[model samples]
Target: MTLNPNLRLRRAARIIVLDPEGRALMFRYDVPGRPPFWVTAGGECEPGESFDAAARRELLEETGIIADPGEEIARLTPEFITVEGEPVQADERFYLVRVSEARIDTSRHTALEQRLMTQHRWFTRAELADWPEAVFPESIVTMIEQQERAR
Candidate 1:
Protein backbone atom coordinates (compact mmCIF):
# COMPACT_ATOMS: atom_id res chain seq x y z
CA MET A 1 0.00 0.00 0.00
CA THR A 2 1.24 3.45 -0.78
CA LEU A 3 1.83 5.56 2.30
CA ASN A 4 0.41 9.06 2.31
CA PRO A 5 3.20 11.56 2.03
CA ASN A 6 1.15 14.10 3.88
CA LEU A 7 1.96 12.16 7.04
CA ARG A 8 5.47 12.82 8.20
CA LEU A 9 7.76 10.10 9.44
CA ARG A 10 7.51 9.44 13.16
CA ARG A 11 10.53 8.40 15.16
CA ALA A 12 9.63 5.79 17.76
CA ALA A 13 11.36 3.50 20.21
CA ARG A 14 10.16 0.11 21.40
CA ILE A 15 11.23 -2.05 24.26
CA ILE A 16 11.42 -5.80 24.00
CA VAL A 17 10.91 -6.42 27.65
CA LEU A 18 11.99 -9.79 28.91
CA ASP A 19 11.11 -10.93 32.39
CA PRO A 20 13.44 -12.86 34.67
CA GLU A 21 12.08 -16.06 33.15
CA GLY A 22 12.96 -14.72 29.68
CA ARG A 23 9.37 -14.35 28.55
CA ALA A 24 8.67 -11.27 26.47
CA LEU A 25 6.11 -8.76 27.69
CA MET A 26 3.60 -7.46 25.17
CA PHE A 27 0.49 -5.36 25.16
CA ARG A 28 -2.74 -6.48 23.54
CA TYR A 29 -4.75 -3.90 21.63
CA ASP A 30 -8.38 -4.67 20.98
CA VAL A 31 -10.16 -2.10 18.92
CA PRO A 32 -13.81 -2.87 18.67
CA GLY A 33 -14.91 -4.09 15.22
CA ARG A 34 -11.32 -4.76 14.23
CA PRO A 35 -9.00 -7.71 14.65
CA PRO A 36 -6.86 -7.63 17.78
CA PHE A 37 -3.09 -7.38 17.71
CA TRP A 38 -0.09 -7.37 20.01
CA VAL A 39 2.65 -4.81 20.25
CA THR A 40 5.66 -4.14 22.37
CA ALA A 41 5.44 -1.28 24.87
CA GLY A 42 6.74 1.89 23.36
CA GLY A 43 5.75 5.00 21.43
CA GLU A 44 6.78 7.98 19.38
CA CYS A 45 9.61 10.13 20.66
CA GLU A 46 8.93 13.57 21.99
CA PRO A 47 10.61 16.55 20.45
CA GLY A 48 14.38 16.50 20.96
CA GLU A 49 14.16 13.16 22.77
CA SER A 50 16.88 10.69 22.01
CA PHE A 51 15.90 7.21 20.95
CA ASP A 52 17.17 5.70 24.22
CA ALA A 53 15.35 8.30 26.24
CA ALA A 54 12.18 7.75 24.26
CA ALA A 55 12.45 4.00 24.75
CA ARG A 56 12.79 4.40 28.49
CA ARG A 57 9.97 6.92 28.66
CA GLU A 58 7.59 4.88 26.53
CA LEU A 59 8.36 1.72 28.46
CA LEU A 60 7.34 3.31 31.73
CA GLU A 61 4.44 5.26 30.29
CA GLU A 62 2.93 2.27 28.56
CA THR A 63 3.69 -0.51 31.06
CA GLY A 64 4.64 1.28 34.29
CA ILE A 65 7.87 -0.66 34.29
CA ILE A 66 10.84 1.49 35.12
CA ALA A 67 13.97 -0.27 33.99
CA ASP A 68 17.10 0.43 32.07
CA PRO A 69 16.65 -0.05 28.34
CA GLY A 70 19.70 -1.74 26.91
CA GLU A 71 21.31 -0.98 23.59
CA GLU A 72 19.29 -0.99 20.39
CA ILE A 73 19.01 -4.46 18.94
CA ALA A 74 17.01 -3.79 15.82
CA ARG A 75 15.55 -1.05 13.67
CA LEU A 76 12.81 -0.85 11.07
CA THR A 77 10.72 1.63 9.17
CA PRO A 78 7.15 0.50 8.79
CA GLU A 79 4.29 2.32 7.13
CA PHE A 80 0.80 1.78 8.40
CA ILE A 81 -2.39 3.49 9.28
CA THR A 82 -2.97 4.53 12.87
CA VAL A 83 -6.06 3.85 14.93
CA GLU A 84 -7.07 7.44 14.35
CA GLY A 85 -7.10 6.73 10.62
CA GLU A 86 -3.96 8.68 10.00
CA PRO A 87 -1.22 7.14 7.94
CA VAL A 88 2.09 6.74 9.75
CA GLN A 89 5.63 6.21 8.61
CA ALA A 90 7.39 4.99 11.70
CA ASP A 91 11.11 4.74 12.18
CA GLU A 92 11.20 2.38 15.10
CA ARG A 93 14.12 1.14 17.11
CA PHE A 94 13.81 -1.89 19.33
CA TYR A 95 15.76 -2.10 22.54
CA LEU A 96 16.20 -5.06 24.82
CA VAL A 97 15.17 -4.55 28.42
CA ARG A 98 14.89 -6.97 31.32
CA VAL A 99 12.36 -6.61 34.07
CA SER A 100 12.02 -8.52 37.30
CA GLU A 101 8.28 -8.91 37.06
CA ALA A 102 5.58 -9.05 34.42
CA ARG A 103 2.99 -7.24 36.48
CA ILE A 104 2.09 -3.88 34.95
CA ASP A 105 0.62 -0.72 36.40
CA THR A 106 -1.67 0.98 33.92
CA SER A 107 -2.12 4.22 35.79
CA ARG A 108 0.25 5.99 33.45
CA HIS A 109 -1.33 5.05 30.14
CA THR A 110 -2.41 7.82 27.85
CA ALA A 111 -6.06 8.22 26.96
CA LEU A 112 -5.59 6.48 23.65
CA GLU A 113 -3.77 3.58 25.26
CA GLN A 114 -6.34 3.21 28.01
CA ARG A 115 -9.04 3.02 25.41
CA LEU A 116 -7.38 0.66 22.91
CA MET A 117 -4.99 -1.46 24.97
CA THR A 118 -6.89 -4.17 26.75
CA GLN A 119 -4.31 -6.46 28.35
CA HIS A 120 -0.72 -7.43 28.79
CA ARG A 121 0.93 -10.83 28.79
CA TRP A 122 4.28 -12.45 29.18
CA PHE A 123 4.95 -14.97 26.46
CA THR A 124 7.74 -17.45 26.08
CA ARG A 125 9.46 -17.80 22.75
CA ALA A 126 7.51 -20.98 22.17
CA GLU A 127 4.26 -19.20 22.93
CA LEU A 128 5.12 -16.36 20.60
CA ALA A 129 5.82 -18.84 17.85
CA ASP A 130 2.24 -20.07 18.07
CA TRP A 131 0.51 -16.81 18.87
CA PRO A 132 -2.69 -16.47 16.87
CA GLU A 133 -3.02 -12.71 17.11
CA ALA A 134 -1.32 -10.37 14.70
CA VAL A 135 2.10 -9.18 15.76
CA PHE A 136 3.39 -5.70 14.90
CA PRO A 137 6.74 -6.41 13.33
CA GLU A 138 5.63 -9.78 11.96
CA SER A 139 9.29 -10.68 12.40
CA ILE A 140 9.14 -10.93 16.17
CA VAL A 141 9.70 -14.68 16.17
CA THR A 142 12.72 -14.45 13.92
CA MET A 143 14.06 -11.52 15.93
CA ILE A 144 13.81 -13.48 19.15
CA GLU A 145 15.40 -16.47 17.52
CA GLN A 146 18.27 -14.36 16.27
CA GLN A 147 18.80 -12.85 19.69
CA GLU A 148 18.84 -16.29 21.22
CA ARG A 149 21.33 -17.48 18.66
CA ALA A 150 23.55 -14.45 19.25
CA ARG A 151 23.76 -15.30 22.91
Candidate 2:
Protein backbone atom coordinates (compact mmCIF):
# COMPACT_ATOMS: atom_id res chain seq x y z
CA MET A 1 0.00 0.00 0.00
CA THR A 2 1.26 3.50 -0.80
CA LEU A 3 1.96 5.60 2.26
CA ASN A 4 -0.07 8.73 2.29
CA PRO A 5 2.16 11.81 2.33
CA ASN A 6 0.07 13.39 5.06
CA LEU A 7 -0.30 10.24 7.13
CA ARG A 8 0.01 10.63 10.85
CA LEU A 9 2.66 8.59 12.62
CA ARG A 10 1.28 6.44 15.40
CA ARG A 11 2.33 3.69 17.79
CA ALA A 12 0.20 0.57 18.31
CA ALA A 13 0.33 -2.21 20.89
CA ARG A 14 -1.18 -5.36 19.38
CA ILE A 15 -1.49 -8.86 20.75
CA ILE A 16 -1.25 -12.33 19.27
CA VAL A 17 -3.73 -13.70 21.78
CA LEU A 18 -3.84 -17.45 21.68
CA ASP A 19 -6.13 -20.00 23.26
CA PRO A 20 -4.84 -23.18 24.87
CA GLU A 21 -5.33 -24.99 21.58
CA GLY A 22 -2.96 -22.57 19.77
CA ARG A 23 -5.61 -20.78 17.77
CA ALA A 24 -5.23 -17.02 17.61
CA LEU A 25 -8.13 -14.67 18.14
CA MET A 26 -8.94 -12.33 15.26
CA PHE A 27 -11.54 -9.77 14.40
CA ARG A 28 -13.00 -9.27 10.95
CA TYR A 29 -13.53 -5.86 9.51
CA ASP A 30 -16.19 -5.39 6.87
CA VAL A 31 -15.39 -1.94 5.66
CA PRO A 32 -18.02 -0.49 3.39
CA GLY A 33 -15.84 -0.04 0.34
CA ARG A 34 -13.14 -2.61 0.91
CA PRO A 35 -12.69 -6.35 1.04
CA PRO A 36 -13.05 -7.76 4.54
CA PHE A 37 -9.83 -8.41 6.43
CA TRP A 38 -8.81 -9.84 9.79
CA VAL A 39 -6.69 -8.28 12.50
CA THR A 40 -5.33 -9.11 15.89
CA ALA A 41 -6.43 -7.20 18.97
CA GLY A 42 -4.86 -3.76 19.38
CA GLY A 43 -5.10 -0.04 18.87
CA GLU A 44 -2.99 3.08 18.88
CA CYS A 45 -1.35 4.11 22.12
CA GLU A 46 -2.61 7.03 24.08
CA PRO A 47 -0.20 9.97 24.39
CA GLY A 48 2.66 9.52 26.83
CA GLU A 49 1.58 5.94 27.45
CA SER A 50 4.03 3.08 27.16
CA PHE A 51 3.58 0.29 24.60
CA ASP A 52 3.26 -2.30 27.36
CA ALA A 53 0.52 -0.30 29.00
CA ALA A 54 -1.20 0.18 25.67
CA ALA A 55 -1.13 -3.56 25.02
CA ARG A 56 -2.81 -4.33 28.30
CA ARG A 57 -5.34 -1.57 27.84
CA GLU A 58 -6.18 -2.54 24.29
CA LEU A 59 -6.62 -6.19 25.20
CA LEU A 60 -9.10 -5.28 27.86
CA GLU A 61 -10.91 -2.66 25.82
CA GLU A 62 -11.21 -4.71 22.67
CA THR A 63 -11.89 -8.14 24.06
CA GLY A 64 -12.78 -7.54 27.71
CA ILE A 65 -9.83 -9.70 28.63
CA ILE A 66 -8.02 -8.63 31.75
CA ALA A 67 -4.63 -10.25 31.57
CA ASP A 68 -1.00 -9.33 31.53
CA PRO A 69 0.33 -8.86 28.04
CA GLY A 70 3.44 -11.01 27.90
CA GLU A 71 6.75 -10.22 26.20
CA GLU A 72 6.88 -8.30 22.97
CA ILE A 73 7.19 -11.00 20.32
CA ALA A 74 7.46 -9.03 17.09
CA ARG A 75 7.32 -5.59 15.56
CA LEU A 76 6.21 -4.10 12.27
CA THR A 77 5.95 -0.72 10.63
CA PRO A 78 2.91 -0.76 8.38
CA GLU A 79 1.23 2.10 6.61
CA PHE A 80 -2.49 1.88 5.99
CA ILE A 81 -5.71 3.77 5.92
CA THR A 82 -7.64 3.55 9.12
CA VAL A 83 -11.29 2.48 9.31
CA GLU A 84 -12.00 6.13 9.89
CA GLY A 85 -10.50 6.87 6.47
CA GLU A 86 -7.41 8.50 7.95
CA PRO A 87 -3.98 7.44 6.77
CA VAL A 88 -1.47 6.29 9.34
CA GLN A 89 2.07 5.06 9.62
CA ALA A 90 1.64 2.48 12.37
CA ASP A 91 4.61 1.52 14.50
CA GLU A 92 3.19 -1.73 15.79
CA ARG A 93 4.44 -4.06 18.50
CA PHE A 94 2.92 -7.52 18.81
CA TYR A 95 2.79 -9.03 22.25
CA LEU A 96 1.94 -12.57 23.28
CA VAL A 97 -1.04 -13.25 25.55
CA ARG A 98 -2.23 -16.76 26.20
CA VAL A 99 -5.72 -17.44 27.44
CA SER A 100 -7.67 -20.53 28.37
CA GLU A 101 -10.86 -19.31 26.77
CA ALA A 102 -11.80 -17.63 23.52
CA ARG A 103 -14.80 -15.66 24.72
CA ILE A 104 -14.69 -11.97 23.78
CA ASP A 105 -16.78 -8.92 24.51
CA THR A 106 -16.89 -6.11 21.97
CA SER A 107 -18.97 -3.78 24.11
CA ARG A 108 -16.08 -1.45 24.69
CA HIS A 109 -15.11 -0.89 21.09
CA THR A 110 -15.09 2.60 19.63
CA ALA A 111 -18.13 3.59 17.59
CA LEU A 112 -16.30 3.17 14.32
CA GLU A 113 -15.11 -0.27 15.35
CA GLN A 114 -18.53 -1.34 16.52
CA ARG A 115 -19.90 -0.62 13.09
CA LEU A 116 -17.14 -1.85 10.81
CA MET A 117 -15.65 -4.71 12.83
CA THR A 118 -18.27 -7.36 12.22
CA GLN A 119 -17.24 -10.53 14.01
CA HIS A 120 -14.51 -12.40 15.84
CA ARG A 121 -13.08 -15.84 15.19
CA TRP A 122 -10.38 -18.11 16.47
CA PHE A 123 -8.07 -19.16 13.62
CA THR A 124 -5.84 -22.16 13.61
CA ARG A 125 -2.39 -21.94 12.01
CA ALA A 126 -3.66 -23.51 8.82
CA GLU A 127 -6.50 -21.05 8.57
CA LEU A 128 -4.23 -18.11 9.22
CA ALA A 129 -2.04 -19.31 6.40
CA ASP A 130 -4.87 -19.42 3.83
CA TRP A 131 -7.87 -17.54 5.17
CA PRO A 132 -8.22 -15.82 1.74
CA GLU A 133 -8.65 -12.42 3.39
CA ALA A 134 -5.70 -10.36 4.50
CA VAL A 135 -4.48 -10.75 8.05
CA PHE A 136 -2.43 -7.89 9.44
CA PRO A 137 1.05 -8.42 10.90
CA GLU A 138 1.22 -11.36 8.48
CA SER A 139 3.99 -13.06 10.46
CA ILE A 140 1.51 -14.38 13.03
CA VAL A 141 2.02 -18.08 12.36
CA THR A 142 5.77 -17.66 12.71
CA MET A 143 5.35 -15.74 15.91
CA ILE A 144 3.02 -18.37 17.34
CA GLU A 145 5.41 -21.16 16.41
CA GLN A 146 8.28 -19.30 18.03
CA GLN A 147 6.24 -18.70 21.14
CA GLU A 148 5.36 -22.36 21.33
CA ARG A 149 8.98 -23.35 20.90
CA ALA A 150 10.08 -21.05 23.71
CA ARG A 151 7.51 -22.45 26.11
Candidate 3:
Protein backbone atom coordinates (compact mmCIF):
# COMPACT_ATOMS: atom_id res chain seq x y z
CA MET A 1 0.00 0.00 0.00
CA THR A 2 1.24 3.47 -0.78
CA LEU A 3 1.76 5.46 2.39
CA ASN A 4 1.06 9.15 2.69
CA PRO A 5 4.08 10.43 4.57
CA ASN A 6 2.51 13.78 5.28
CA LEU A 7 -0.43 12.29 7.15
CA ARG A 8 -0.06 12.35 10.90
CA LEU A 9 -0.90 9.01 12.47
CA ARG A 10 -2.44 8.86 15.92
CA ARG A 11 -3.91 6.24 18.22
CA ALA A 12 -7.39 6.95 19.54
CA ALA A 13 -10.24 5.28 21.37
CA ARG A 14 -13.97 5.79 21.03
CA ILE A 15 -16.90 4.41 22.98
CA ILE A 16 -20.36 3.64 21.77
CA VAL A 17 -21.99 4.18 25.14
CA LEU A 18 -25.49 2.75 25.39
CA ASP A 19 -27.94 3.74 28.07
CA PRO A 20 -30.08 1.15 29.81
CA GLU A 21 -32.91 1.88 27.43
CA GLY A 22 -30.67 1.23 24.38
CA ARG A 23 -29.99 4.78 23.30
CA ALA A 24 -26.45 5.78 22.49
CA LEU A 25 -24.90 8.94 23.84
CA MET A 26 -23.62 11.49 21.35
CA PHE A 27 -22.15 14.95 21.47
CA ARG A 28 -22.81 17.75 18.99
CA TYR A 29 -19.63 19.48 17.87
CA ASP A 30 -20.18 23.01 16.68
CA VAL A 31 -16.98 24.04 15.04
CA PRO A 32 -16.85 27.51 13.64
CA GLY A 33 -17.86 27.93 9.99
CA ARG A 34 -18.56 24.23 9.62
CA PRO A 35 -21.87 22.47 10.01
CA PRO A 36 -22.51 20.77 13.35
CA PHE A 37 -21.74 17.07 13.64
CA TRP A 38 -22.28 14.36 16.21
CA VAL A 39 -19.76 11.88 17.55
CA THR A 40 -19.37 9.31 20.30
CA ALA A 41 -17.31 10.08 23.40
CA GLY A 42 -13.63 9.57 22.79
CA GLY A 43 -10.29 11.21 22.13
CA GLU A 44 -6.69 10.59 21.26
CA CYS A 45 -4.63 8.34 23.47
CA GLU A 46 -2.15 10.28 25.51
CA PRO A 47 1.51 9.54 24.89
CA GLY A 48 2.20 5.88 25.69
CA GLU A 49 -1.40 5.20 26.82
CA SER A 50 -3.15 2.02 25.76
CA PHE A 51 -6.41 2.07 23.85
CA ASP A 52 -8.45 0.65 26.73
CA ALA A 53 -7.04 3.08 29.24
CA ALA A 54 -7.58 5.98 26.88
CA ALA A 55 -11.14 4.80 26.34
CA ARG A 56 -11.82 4.78 30.05
CA ARG A 57 -10.21 8.15 30.61
CA GLU A 58 -11.93 9.82 27.66
CA LEU A 59 -15.29 8.38 28.76
CA LEU A 60 -14.92 9.93 32.18
CA GLU A 61 -13.71 13.23 30.81
CA GLU A 62 -16.48 13.49 28.26
CA THR A 63 -19.44 11.95 30.13
CA GLY A 64 -18.42 12.10 33.78
CA ILE A 65 -19.09 8.37 34.12
CA ILE A 66 -16.48 5.97 35.33
CA ALA A 67 -17.11 2.59 33.73
CA ASP A 68 -15.11 -0.13 32.08
CA PRO A 69 -15.01 0.17 28.36
CA GLY A 70 -17.21 -2.89 27.88
CA GLU A 71 -15.51 -4.54 24.93
CA GLU A 72 -13.31 -3.87 21.95
CA ILE A 73 -15.94 -4.43 19.31
CA ALA A 74 -14.88 -2.49 16.23
CA ARG A 75 -11.93 -0.76 14.65
CA LEU A 76 -11.55 1.87 11.96
CA THR A 77 -9.01 4.17 10.40
CA PRO A 78 -10.48 7.47 9.44
CA GLU A 79 -8.82 10.56 8.09
CA PHE A 80 -9.99 13.87 9.43
CA ILE A 81 -8.90 17.27 10.52
CA THR A 82 -8.05 17.57 14.18
CA VAL A 83 -9.48 20.29 16.42
CA GLU A 84 -6.14 22.01 15.98
CA GLY A 85 -6.70 21.94 12.21
CA GLU A 86 -4.00 19.45 11.49
CA PRO A 87 -4.74 16.58 9.12
CA VAL A 88 -4.59 13.20 10.80
CA GLN A 89 -5.17 9.55 10.14
CA ALA A 90 -6.69 8.16 13.32
CA ASP A 91 -6.18 4.52 14.22
CA GLU A 92 -9.33 4.29 16.28
CA ARG A 93 -10.59 1.42 18.36
CA PHE A 94 -14.27 1.43 19.18
CA TYR A 95 -15.57 -0.05 22.42
CA LEU A 96 -19.07 -0.84 23.55
CA VAL A 97 -19.81 0.66 26.98
CA ARG A 98 -23.22 -0.01 28.45
CA VAL A 99 -24.52 1.84 31.47
CA SER A 100 -27.40 1.19 33.80
CA GLU A 101 -28.93 4.57 33.12
CA ALA A 102 -28.55 7.52 30.77
CA ARG A 103 -26.34 10.11 32.37
CA ILE A 104 -24.06 12.85 31.10
CA ASP A 105 -22.06 15.70 32.60
CA THR A 106 -19.69 17.87 30.61
CA SER A 107 -18.12 19.85 33.41
CA ARG A 108 -14.94 17.82 33.09
CA HIS A 109 -14.46 18.30 29.36
CA THR A 110 -11.08 19.46 28.13
CA ALA A 111 -10.91 22.98 26.84
CA LEU A 112 -11.05 21.94 23.21
CA GLU A 113 -14.00 19.64 23.81
CA GLN A 114 -15.74 22.24 25.93
CA ARG A 115 -15.42 24.86 23.25
CA LEU A 116 -16.39 22.74 20.23
CA MET A 117 -18.95 20.51 21.91
CA THR A 118 -22.15 22.43 22.41
CA GLN A 119 -24.67 19.76 23.37
CA HIS A 120 -25.17 16.13 24.28
CA ARG A 121 -28.08 13.80 23.63
CA TRP A 122 -29.17 10.18 23.51
CA PHE A 123 -30.17 8.72 20.15
CA THR A 124 -31.45 5.47 18.83
CA ARG A 125 -29.89 3.71 15.87
CA ALA A 126 -32.60 5.05 13.62
CA GLU A 127 -31.97 8.59 14.78
CA LEU A 128 -28.28 8.17 14.25
CA ALA A 129 -28.84 6.98 10.71
CA ASP A 130 -31.16 9.82 9.84
CA TRP A 131 -30.10 12.67 12.06
CA PRO A 132 -29.99 16.08 10.44
CA GLU A 133 -26.38 16.46 11.46
CA ALA A 134 -23.66 14.17 10.23
CA VAL A 135 -22.17 11.54 12.49
CA PHE A 136 -18.50 10.66 12.47
CA PRO A 137 -17.19 7.39 11.03
CA GLU A 138 -20.13 7.69 8.61
CA SER A 139 -20.72 3.97 9.16
CA ILE A 140 -21.58 4.11 12.84
CA VAL A 141 -25.04 2.56 12.44
CA THR A 142 -23.76 -0.60 10.81
CA MET A 143 -20.70 -0.88 12.99
CA ILE A 144 -22.82 -0.49 16.12
CA GLU A 145 -25.37 -3.02 14.90
CA GLN A 146 -22.76 -5.63 14.06
CA GLN A 147 -21.06 -5.27 17.42
CA GLU A 148 -24.28 -5.02 19.40
CA ARG A 149 -25.73 -8.08 17.73
CA ALA A 150 -22.60 -10.04 18.47
CA ARG A 151 -23.17 -9.38 22.19
lDDT values for all models: 0.84, 0.90, 0.87
26-144 in candidate 3: lDDT tens per residue?
Answer: 99999887888899999999999999999999999999999999668878887788867788888899988889889788899878887999899999989988988889868888887
1-151 per-residue lDDT for model 1 (tens digits): 3444777888999888888898988889988777999988898899999999999999889888887888888998888777777678888899888777767788999899899998888988888878898877777777777777888
Model 2, stretches more than 4 Å misplaced? Answer: 1-6
Give the winner by TM-score: 3
Worst 10 residues of 3 by lDDT: 1-10
What clash pairs does model 3 have? none
How far does residue 86 in candidate 2 sit from its true spot (Å)? 1.8
Global Cα lDDT for candidate 2: 0.90
Error of 3 at 34 (Å): 1.3
Model 1 TM-score on a 0 to 1 scale: 0.89
Q: List the residue pairs that clash in candidate 1.
A: none
Alpha carbon deviation, residue 98, candidate 3 (Å): 0.6
- lDDT per residue as tens, model 2, 1-151: 4444577888999998898888999999999899999999999999999999999999999999999997788888888898878878888989999898878888999898888889999999999999899998788898889988998
TM-score of each: 0.89, 0.93, 0.93
For model 2, name the residue pairs that clash.
Answer: none
RMSD of 2: 2.3
